[model samples]
Target: MTMAENGTDTAAPQEGEQQQIQMQILAQYIRDMSFENIVAQKGLHGGEVTPEIQVQIGLDARKRPVENQYEVILKFNIESKNKDSEDKMFLMEIEYGGIFHVAGVPEDQLHPFLLIECPRHLFPYVRRIVADATHDGGFPQLNLEPVDFVQLYRQQAAAQQQAAAQSAQA
Candidate 1:
């Protein structure tokens, strides 16, 4: 096996090989964003505040009118609350989207490719936005842990399969 120019492993070509897969990000942008500081709104002050944060993620993808183009969106919902009082500290919701031009990916693999790889490319920007939102909201900067896209994709696939089976039985 040898590494292709794109840094992916490829077997030495002895026969006519399929075209190499190609992908390019055409654009990335924040579709929507909101941040609210509940503590500030409530006029709370003066205490050692320990925060517990929850992060929820959702993904969506759709084919664009343009050929070989798809739009993928990653949605994030984050909430922080005081550990002791359980009062809400802040809330943030952001939807980040990317337009990708992808070609040569087999039809069966395209779904996973958009859901996993595209989001991975967009995550760092999302992280930075989250950190800034929290810090600028007058709280300690919140750095999100890295997400495991592969595991997430597998779980979603399993759930879909289970739902289909249940529906068929019903």
Candidate 2:
């Protein structure tokens, strides 16, 4: 077997062939996780409780080629304010993430696996943690509904494409 000039075996990966991919959860961690109940007590005692809740969510993904793994992080911040008092009644923040190892997958499949599959796999555990933390913080259990990551991914992709198209047209 002769090595290519780049020192990699040229014959290893064949074109148009379906590679046997192996995916595993190498490690899952809340790398920089934080849950803050900014107005837990206030919400319970404050008069004119506001039913309005503001929620902000952010997502990020990073790949570690050396470990052949990817890390996907989801961050959320929620705030509830009293409409009358104009003061915050409840605040909750969660930063959760997961690590996945994917190998031998086709290039076309990698994005979906990371953006959709990995997050779907990790959501349950993250939801559990968030619920427990909120309950322990003197709030009702935050029973977050399951999220459809695939739909979310597709929506995001479509929005990006639309934006790009608009920009090009402009």
Candidate 3:
């Protein structure tokens, strides 16, 4: 029988024989960040200008094939607007990234590990960055609440499954 039917490749390294499966963080950094005080002066006075602050968070990951590494990026967007009007007070966006040297982790679990755990590890720093950026922008220090990445991941998975089921039914 040919090697194709036997599920063995003679031409390259096998997945089973790959090196030790350990995940290590090689580096962490701020990939990009932006803070804009739309009304720089109007929002500077600090007594009681109530603004509704809305924050959005997102996560992404990719493989660095050259070094068998993975990069996880956490995105945070915080926007503040006047409580009664539609005027924007301040908007801040921060993209935090970490380069992880990953080995020995199974392909089945890799996605979750990267999306959930990696960002969970990097969130505090990103949160501080957001706070600092806002404080420097003439606003009160913005403190972010803890993020539940596992819950977010579960929601995404459920949404995907629901979409697939709908399409299949149609």
Query: Considering every candidate listed, which one attains the maximal lDDT?
Result: 1
Model 1 / residue 147 / CA error / Å: 1.0
Give the per-residue lDDT of model 3 (tens digit) for 108-152: 988988888888889989888888888898778998999999998
Local error of candidate 1 at residue 42 (angstroms):
1.0
Candidate 3 whole-model C-alpha lDDT, 0 to 1? 0.84
List candidate 1 stretches off by more than 4 Å. 1-16
Number of the top candidate by TM-score? Answer: 1
Q: Model 3 off-target regions past 4 Å?
A: 1-21, 41-47, 163-170
Q: Rate the local accuracy (lDDT) of all candidates.
A: 0.93, 0.74, 0.84
Which of 1 and 2 is ahead in TM-score? 1
Each model's backbone clash number: 0, 0, 3
RMSD of each: 4.6, 7.2, 8.7
Model 1 C-alpha lDDT per residue in residues 1-170, reported as the tens digit of each score: 79989999787655667767888999999999999998889999948888899999988999999999999999999999899999998999999999999998999999999999999999999999999989998888999999999898898889899999999999
- Which residue pairs in candidate 2 have backbone atoms (N, alpha carbon, C) closer than 3 angstroms, thus clashing? none
Ranking by TM-score: 1, 3, 2
TM-score, predicted candidate 3 vs. hidden true structure: 0.77
